[model samples]
Target: MAVLTLVLLLAGLVLGALTAGAAPDKQAIVGSALGLEGKLGAAIAKAPAGAGAGQIDSSAPRGFLGIPGAPQVNPILAFLWAVWVGWIFSTVGAFGGIMAGVGHMTIFGLGDYAKSFKKTAPELNKVLTDCIRMANQWLVGLSSAISSLNYLRSKRLAWPLGLALGAGSLFGAVVIPIMTGGKISFSQYQGWFGVAVFVVGGFLLYETTPKGQAGKKAAKAAAQAFEKSVKEGGESAQGIAVKKWGLTRIEFSFFGVEFGFNPFWAFIGGVLIAAISSFLGVGGGFLYVPYLTSIVGLPMFVVAGTSALAVLLSMVTSIASYLNFAGAAVDWALIGVELVGIFIGSMVGPRTQKYIPDIWLKRLFVVLALYVGLGYFSKGFFGQSWVPM
Candidate 1:
């Protein structure tokens, strides 16, 4: 099953790389649709009607035969560029897509593609965002799948929580992002996204403080339970087993620890998580995993699996909605490459996670959350990155 999953992800990577880069410039597509094909018209006039082929096509092949074309990037380069994306996803269970987006807008900027949009700043920003969302969805979705499988096999997944969260996330990931008549510009998207990240970061930081030592204690206890269970039943027995599940309540046992949670509350939280993640082009791990561990009081191990499942579901919903409604174009070449790395890393991260203590995960979360949250807040509100351009 593991090998098969890896194979499937690799196949998808190749296919996405082959076609995603073939997407036409966003401005050209919209312009042609709106009957603003003056350039194409002029070019057509300049060509002789004999053997010379002067044409204008939106869905033309851009990256066939190892040639990188407009919007279509080289798969090899994309793969190299996306290593960090996969590594990050595997580690924390989210934000891989958002990180990719940030990369695309800066050092690894899509200069050639954005330059084509000479219409206006908003138009160019729109294309940039569309690329980010498209890449984010595909890259993170595959990453979540790999991680979720590993977690599920370990028996740590909170099925009831995952389902409840998925239910609300379906709408939040789909309906909310495309509600407006037109696309949201980068500034507007970033502003709202920044606020969301900032709040989540603040909460997580609080959890790391002395007052939030309850979470720390809980982590220590869970780790001890994991160790005890492993000794008693072997590694196979050191996982979560559902005791009960219902509309309002959820019950499960991890190793030797019993855990109960409010499904309805998880559903509510899922809605919020999905909304922010979908709009901001993230998998909601940075937020979801922390929420489960710190607020929902689930163990760090359990949170990883539960959040991974929820993130996959939400990404699926977000991808479908954006493509179907917003007509958002995907940077398949970039995402496909990222997916490959993500799949491999995700598979490894979960399997090797048994050795790590819970405190380390939470500490990692707190630091990353504070940094990313503040950075995003600055970018969104001030129209600049936390450090600089």
Candidate 2:
């Protein structure tokens, strides 16, 4: 499985570079196809007997049709593009999930450690908080330095770093459960915390953001273009609302089957999940996948495809956010290594899905949800720390 994943990834990278270079000029072709022309016209009123001289002045129409270039995208190439994109996104989602898991463990574990000390030495609570805060800052700085170093290296150091971090995180996760007497550290709780954090953080960032200021300057430009479309088209209330909210519908036919959805909504959902996950230390996919499947009423297969697309968008947003706000704390090497593993895992997932019964899958989801809910309830009500119970 690992070997297959690596091969696919290499192929995707090669294909991506080739496609980027070979993409045809859309502007020239579209312009030619439309046969658009620019002209000026004037109205003339004839006086009695003959319009000996009708005044003529420069006059311009309020509008003109302009066709932009359209890329000559071959169907086969497009399908390949979709596959490669899907693979890339799935890999990133996997990375996000692992990072969220590890990060949450670190936070929760430290919190518990603080409680244990504070319980016995009440005066040390303030000191513990200060120490944790300092440690967090130091960790951020260290991660940033490592990331810079990794970027400079010829060969990626992601694998080794990932192994170390993953091992340490897993150990912490395991120990937390055992230390808590197995009563509080349920998998469900961890998943929920991760999902909640990703969702909430994403929402806050986007909602509170001043209009047209949440993303890169290019994204703002796209928003402006969309707004212009609304104005020019004289769209209806619903159309205007959708345009204002950045809704976009996309359709594709695959293997004789038609699939379609609003990519914008899916992207927003992913971003919301990613932000919340960052805060809570869990993967955003827990919420994203469920929402895509259950709420969006998509089949499991299509849900996976759509979620992968959304995850890619979310990761882009996340990377942007981290670079702007938390770059110092992120471990790029670790992310890269985990991505390799995730890529492998994601490829395997599709095959597994083919064999798993729908009933079983649904039941599994329900069980996971129940477990997480119970864990949170216990933690909030009993004030139980997340140690191994």
Candidate 3:
């Protein structure tokens, strides 16, 4: 797996470099962008005319999409951040997209850059937000694919449930871009993104408490058994087995512990998750993790893989819709570097996860989510920091 990851990363780097070519010269890029004024005008017809007059400064250094004075991301930092993004998602089966969003919007300074255009060039700000959202999905999409393949090979993935969720998510993913793409501004996007994560973080924190774990007896038993098997070096032989499959309920077992979920409700849950995820430009794994644990009573070992499968399917529709229908563009050069890192990080996660306790995994991300959520939410919504961040 490590060798395969390295090979994929190298190949991706070469392909992305060849396809993206060198960065365009500022004058040429500015000229080309202005040449499309007629089309750009029509695209932003929803915005008032002359709103962004004199906003274009050809003398400024080019950034993403040839925007003047926009912050240029360092490739090394982007790669490192993506590696972290892949690791978290693959390890815990959640927060990969939110972390990716944080990198694009905050770590790279793109969020502030886009927010600068909210009033002068509301259309531009919205477009940049869409691009950020789409870029986030790209990282999640690749990580989820790799993670899903790894989990599936180990027999930890729930194919029926993942596929059902994927199918249901297709509807929401497709509809969201058409309805809200090119419509959300950076501030609004950031504010809402923070809110979603913050709320989930609080819920997950409660889940780690004794009271919350009270109802999860089966999950706890399975987790303990899986942990014991891992320590004994015999877990690879133990995998999920389907006990019963019916129209109403799907039953499965791991380590002799049983779990079941309603297929119909799972589909509905998928729809709602995808709608919110697509709008937020995330993989929806954060939500999926809670659902798998709280509602379905699955152990972490199974939840990660199942979440990865669902994310893989949902990201495909979400990315295509944003690009084709929403007119969003991504920096392939940057994404290429990030993809290589993501592949490497994803390969490491599954191998190392067995050593950590299930509760610890959830706890680690919950802390991060709450901190980031509070910072972004308060700043984005109120123009002031509620936390010291």
Candidate 4:
């Protein structure tokens, strides 16, 4: 699977690079887009009931369409976008949405342009949001699967944990999305998401502070000891191995250290994580990593792969739900542009992670979560992000 993902990534890179060399000129784009508009307008004019802008409205996104005066994006920029998303996902098993949002915002200011666009073409915004969600979810799911292949080959993933989490994710991502049917607006989602994750981020950040020095010191010492053992030619043996898998609970050993968790609670966590992720268009790894490490008492070494597996499963179900229930329409042109780069980035993240210490990775995760979580919270609660539409 790993080899397959790598081969696909390389092939895509070569083909995309070649195609980008002959990008269309600005006049051509205007002609094509306007031509499309003409066709759509004409088709609507001939409709039996009534034909107008309301019936055939288009909220087409700029910058991504290679239109005149739009942000110019070729395979290179798209590839880099994928690489960025993949690196974040592979390293921490999440952050794909935030990176993609930042990438899209480059075309225009995030809330400012969106608010204006939605004001003019209200219904079209719903379809556009759904399409973007589908594309981003697909990217996350594929990247996570690619990253998990190597971990699976090396037996680093805890299958029991994955199964439990995946089951819950299916419920959270698929069934729940279908039930809601896009009733939640973007700002409403943002506000709720901010309030929920703010607490998690704050708690994790505090754990790294001086007041929580005991845990930090212990984690750092363990990491240093493991590094020294490896340097002295002795196997540090920091890997997860399943000891017991059962109906209600499962137990595992990490680097000769044992831990147990209730499968039911993990499943419940998976449900909550997937519910939020399906709405937010993320892989839910940020939530999963913290849950596994802090709440479940699992070592950080095993959390990446486990979280990735869970994310992959959730994305699979969530994607189906979005298309089926949310009426999402994917932008294939944009997706093709980024898939190759994301694959490369995701594949490299796990392989290179060995050089970094476990304590450092956890620290990185906490800091990112705090920063991102607070940004979401502040914007949702106090900023102008919530456009009451």
RMSD, one per candidate, in order: 17.5, 33.6, 17.5, 18.3
lDDT of 1 by residue, 1-389 (tens): 99999999999999999788787554322232222222222222232222111222434444321112334555665665576556555665444555565555443545323423323333434544555555655666655555566776655677778888878787688776677312665556555655755565566566667877787788889989988888543355566678987777788888778888888888889999888777767666667876888798988877877887888788877877776666555545566566676566556666656777545765776666566666656765675667544
Tell me how many residue pairs clash in candidate 3: 0
**TM-scores for every predicted model:** 0.60, 0.31, 0.69, 0.61
- lDDT of candidate 2 over 6-81, digit per residue (tens): 9999999999999988966532111121232211000011111111111111122211111111112233432333
Q: What's each prediction's clash count?
A: 2, 27, 0, 0
The C-alpha stretches of model 4 lying farther than 4 A from their native spots are: 1-96, 105-123, 192-218, 225-247, 251-258, 299-305, 339-389
Candidate 4 per-residue lDDT over residues 1-389, each given as its tens digit? 99999999999999999889876653211112333232222322232221222222233344433211223456677788778777766775444556665455332233333223243334333444444455556666565556666666665777788888889988899876676544544444445555544555556566667766787788889989988888556777677778888878788887787888899998999999898777766667667888888898776667777887888788878887776776655547677778777778888888878988645665776765555556555554665533222
Q: Show the colliding residue pairs in model 1.
A: 21-72, 155-240
Superposed on all Cα atoms, model 3 deviates from the true structure by an RMSD in Å of: 17.5
Evaluate model 1: give its lDDT. 0.61
Cα displacement (angstroms), candidate 3, residue 230, comes to: 16
TM-score of 2: 0.31
Instruction: Write down the worst ten-residue block by lDDT for model 2.
Output: 39-48
Per-candidate Cα lDDT values, in order, are 0.61, 0.36, 0.76, 0.62
Q: Quick one: best lDDT, which candidate?
A: 3
